[model samples]
Target: MTLLSEFQQTQLPASYANLDPATLTQHIQAAKAQLGSKLLLLAHHYQKDEIVAQADFVGDSLQLAQLAAKNHQADYIVFCGVHFMAETADMLTAADQQVILPDLNAGCSMADMANMYQVTAAWQAIQARYPDEVMPVTYVNSSAAVKAFVGEHGGVIVTSGNAEKVLQWAFTQKQRLFFLPDQHLGRNTAYQLGVPLEQMVLWDPTQGQFKGQADQATRIILWEGWCAVHQQFNVAQIKALRVQDPAIKIIVHPECAYEVVQAADVVGSTHKIMTTVQQSPQATHWAVGTDHNLVQRMQATLPQKIDFINPIACACMTMNRIKLPHLAWCLDQLVAGQVPNQIKVDPETTEKSLSALQRMLMLS
Candidate 1:
C-alpha cells in the first residue's frame, strides 16, 4: 500500500509574528464571525486556553471527532490538536466538510511510534507465531494507515476512557490481543481486568519481535510506545505530592507508567480527570498527572484545589505547536478563500479506517 506524503507547514508571515495575543484573538473572532455557522473550531482539552476560548466545541480527541461528524452544517472544521486527531476528524466528518490542522508539524509522538512498515512487519511475525489466536487492537492515537490496517484485519480501536471495555471485547473475539502504540495504557488496562504481569509481553518494534519469549499464557502483546508527557510523571512526583499534601487525591491518566497509575488514588482519561476535579468539592485538594495545560486550566478555575504532580510543566510539545498565531493565520487563510493545513485521508483509507473507528464507537 502506498503512503501519503508528509504535509509541511510553512513559516508564518512576519505580520502574524508581529501581532500581539490580543490582536490574534481579535483576528480569530472576526474570522469566525465572518464564516458564521460554516466554520466549526474544535479544540482538545490539552490545547492552550486561547485556542479553547475560540473553539466552537472543546473536548477529548474522540469526542471532538464525533462532534465534527454530528455537526454536518459546518463547511470547515478547524481542529486544534495533533495531526492524528485532525486525521480522525477528517475521516469522521462528511467529505464536503474540510478538516484543517493549524500546524501540520503538530503530531503525536506515541502515534508516530507505530507506522505502516513497522506495524505490518510486526503483524506478519505475530501471525506466524499465534496463527488465528491474536486480534489487533489499536489505540485511537495512531495513524489512519495503522487504523486501516486494523480494520482490514477485523480489529477495533480503543480510547483511554473506554480501553477496558474495548480490551474486554477484544479478548472475547480472540485468544490473544495485539495492542498498538502505548504499552503503558495496554499494561495498565489489562492489569485492571485481572491479567497478571507475566501473562503480558512487550513487542519491540525496533527489534521487529517480542522482547522476550511468548508462551501460550501470553494474553497481550504491547507495542513499546508511550506518551512523552505522561511518562514524565514518575513515582518520585507522586511521593512528593503525597508528602506535601497527604489528603490530596492523586488522579492520573492511564497513559502514565503502570507504577504511577498504581500509586495514584484514581486513574482515568483527560475528560475524567477534568470532570473529577471540577465536580469535586471545593475543599478537596487534588493532584493531577497529565498534560500541563489542562492542569493549569483546572488550577485557574479551582484555585488552591488543584496542582500538577510534576511541578515542572509536563506539556505535550506537539500539541503546543498550535499556538494563537497559527490559529489566527489558519482562520485568516480560510477567510481569504484558501484552505491552509487541510487534513484529508484518501477515500480507500477513510472507508477502511472508519470501520475500525465505528467498532470503537459502537462498543463505547
Candidate 2:
C-alpha cells in the first residue's frame, strides 16, 4: 500500500489549513458532482467533530457495518474509523463496490495487542495445560486474522453490548474460555456473569504467560490489553463529580476500568450512551465517560445539563489522523481513476473471517 509520504504531510496545500465553511461546502459540492451520489461516508463517534459533522451515518462498529450492507446504491464506502472497521465493512458488503479508508495508519491500539503468531502460540500452550476444557472467545476489537483463528478454534466475536451474554453462552459450550485483546471488558463482563474475580486470569501476550490462576472451572479467560482512551476514566473523577454535583448522573462505557464502571449509574456502548441522554427526562445533569468526540457531540446537540466526568478530555490521537483533507484527497484520487490505498483482505482470510462476524450478527 502506497500511503502518505512524510514530505506530503508537511507540505500540504496552505489552502487546506484555512478552508472556511463556504469554501469547504463548495469543494464538497464539486466532489459530489464529480463522484456522484453513489458514495457513502461512515464516521465513528470517536472521530473528530469536523469529520463527524459530514458523516452520512454515525455510530459504533456493528451499526456502521450494517449501514454499509444496506446502502446498495453506493459505489464507494469511505470509512472514517480505523482499519478493522473498513475491513469488516468490506467483508459484509458487496464485493465489487469500493471500500476506502482515508488514512491507512489509523488502527486500533487494542486490536493490535493480539496477533496471529502470539495467539497461535498461546492456544497451543492453553491446550497443553488445560486441554479440552479451554474454549477460545474474542472481542470484536481484534484483527481479522485473530477472528479467523477464533473461528477455527470454535470461538466467536463479541461486542461490548453483548459480551456478558456471550460469555454466559461460551461457558455453556465449553468448560473454560479465553477472551482476548481487552482484559478490562472481558474481566468485568465475566465477573457480572457470577465468575469469581479470583477465577478469572489474564494471558500476557508479551511474556507469553497467564496471570495467577486457581481452579479449572473458571469460564472466562482474559487477555492483557485495553483501549487507552477508555482506560483514562477513573474512580477519582467520578468521586470528584459526586462531591461537586451529586445531582449529576455518571454514564460510562463498558470499556472503562472496572472500578469506574462500578461507580457509573449507567454502563453501555457509545450508541447506548447517546440514546440514554437523549431520552432521559429527569433533567438531572450528566457526566459522561467515553470517547471525546461523542461527548462533544452530546454537549453540542443537547442544550441540557451534561458534562464530562473528567475535566481534561482524553482523545484517541490515531482516530484524529483521518481528517477531512485526507478524506477528500483519498476520494479525489479514486475519482481521478487512480486506485490508491484500497484495503483488500486476502480472499481465503475473508471467507473464514465472515463466519466469526456472522456468528455475532446471528446471535445479536
Candidate 3:
C-alpha cells in the first residue's frame, strides 16, 4: 500500500480505556504510587486517542524534546511517537533517564530519507559544486545520522516552527544553505521570505546535481524528501473540498506541498492545528491535513466541527504502528523492571546529533 493508504498492523491494539473514569484514575494514582519518580509519559500530537489522552505531556518534536530534557525527576520517558522522536528525547534527557518507544518498528519515512552515508555523499557532492561556501541545514523530521552530518560540519537543523528564521540565520552565517528531508517546506519558506523561485533549485538524489529550471544557486536548495501524508493533500483535493464545503476552514502542516499550504487558511505544526481549533470562538469547521490519528481524535472531540479534508483518508502508517497494545505492553515491561523497547544512541552519534539540535535551539 502507498504511504497515504497504508495501515499495517505489527501488533494488536489492546483496551486501555475499558475502565471507568474513576477506576482509570485509581490505576494511574496507583502506578504513580508504586513507580514514584520513574515515569513520565510524553506523547506526540499525532498519537492515537487512547495514548494521547493519558500522556503526562503532549506536543510536537521540539516541545517534546524540551519536556523530556527538563523533566529530570523522571527516570523513564515512555515516548508515544516515532523512533526518531524517541531518539531525540533520549539525546536531550540526562544519561540516567531511559527513553522507550512502544513499538520498535514505528519509524518516520521522512527520517529514513537521509542517513549518514547518503547525507555524507550528498554533502560532499554539493561541496564539490559550491565548496565550503554552502552550509548543510536539515529539517527536524530527519534521522540523528543526518543531524550529526550537519552538526559535525558546522551546519544547522530547522523545525517547522522556526524554518524561515533559521534559514535567514543560516544565510547570515554562510553564503548558501542546503535544506534536507522536506523539499516542500524549504521551498515554501524560501519563497515566503522573498527568495525568488528562480534562485531555488531541487537537489536530485539519484544524479547528485541541481535539476530545476532555476539556475541561480543563491536561494534555498531543497532535498527530494517529503511527507507522504502531507503530499496527499494535493491541489485537486483542496479544490474539491472547497467546492463541497466552502465554510470549512482549511488548515495544514507546513510539510505539505506549497499549493496545499497556500490553499489552507492556516499553516502550522500539529500542535498549532489543535490549538487553533481550541481557541476558535464559534463552532468553526476545519479540514485538517496531517496524521489520521490526530484528525480523528479532533473529530471525536469536536464531532460537529472538525473532519479529515482528504476524501481518501491520509494515514501515516509508521505513526500508527504504536497502538494501545504496544504501548501497554511496553509500559507493563517497564513496570515489571524490564526494559522492553529501549532505544539508545551511541555516544559518538549522540555528541554530533546533539549539536544539530543545539543549533536549532540557538536559532530559536
How close is each model in CA RMSD to the real structure? Answer: 1.5, 3.0, 4.7
Q: Candidate 3 clashing pairs?
A: none
In Å, residue 300's CA in model 3 sits off its true spot by 2.7
The estimated TM-scores of all candidates read 0.97, 0.92, 0.88
Candidate 3 lDDT, tens digit per residue, 1-364? Answer: 1121222333433455454555544555465467766899888888777678778888888788778767889889888888878888888888988887877778888878776666777778777777777888888787767777788888888888788888888878887778997999898888777787778888777666667653435666788889888878877877788788887788888999988888889988777788888788556878888888888877777644776778576588888776655666566567789776777776787899888888887777
- Estimate every model's Cα lDDT from 0 to 1: 0.89, 0.79, 0.77
lDDT (Cα, 0-100) at 260 in candidate 2: 91
Instruction: Flag the better candidate by TM-score, 2 or 3.
Output: 2
Global lDDT of model 2: 0.79
lDDT of residue 297 for candidate 3: 79
Best by TM-score: 1
Model 3 CA lDDT for position 215: 44
Candidate 1 clashing pairs, residues 3+ apart or interchain? none
lDDT of each residue in 1-364, candidate 1, tens digit only: 3233555566788899899999999999999999999999999999999888888889986688678778889999999998888888889988899989988878889998998999999999999989989999999999999999999899999999889999998999999999999999999999999999999999999989899879889999999999999988899888988888789899999999999999999999988888887788889999899999988898887754887888785699889888899999999999999998788899999999988999888887
Q: Which stretches of model 2 miss by more than 4 angstroms? A: 1-22
Model 3 whole-model lDDT (C-alpha atoms): 0.77
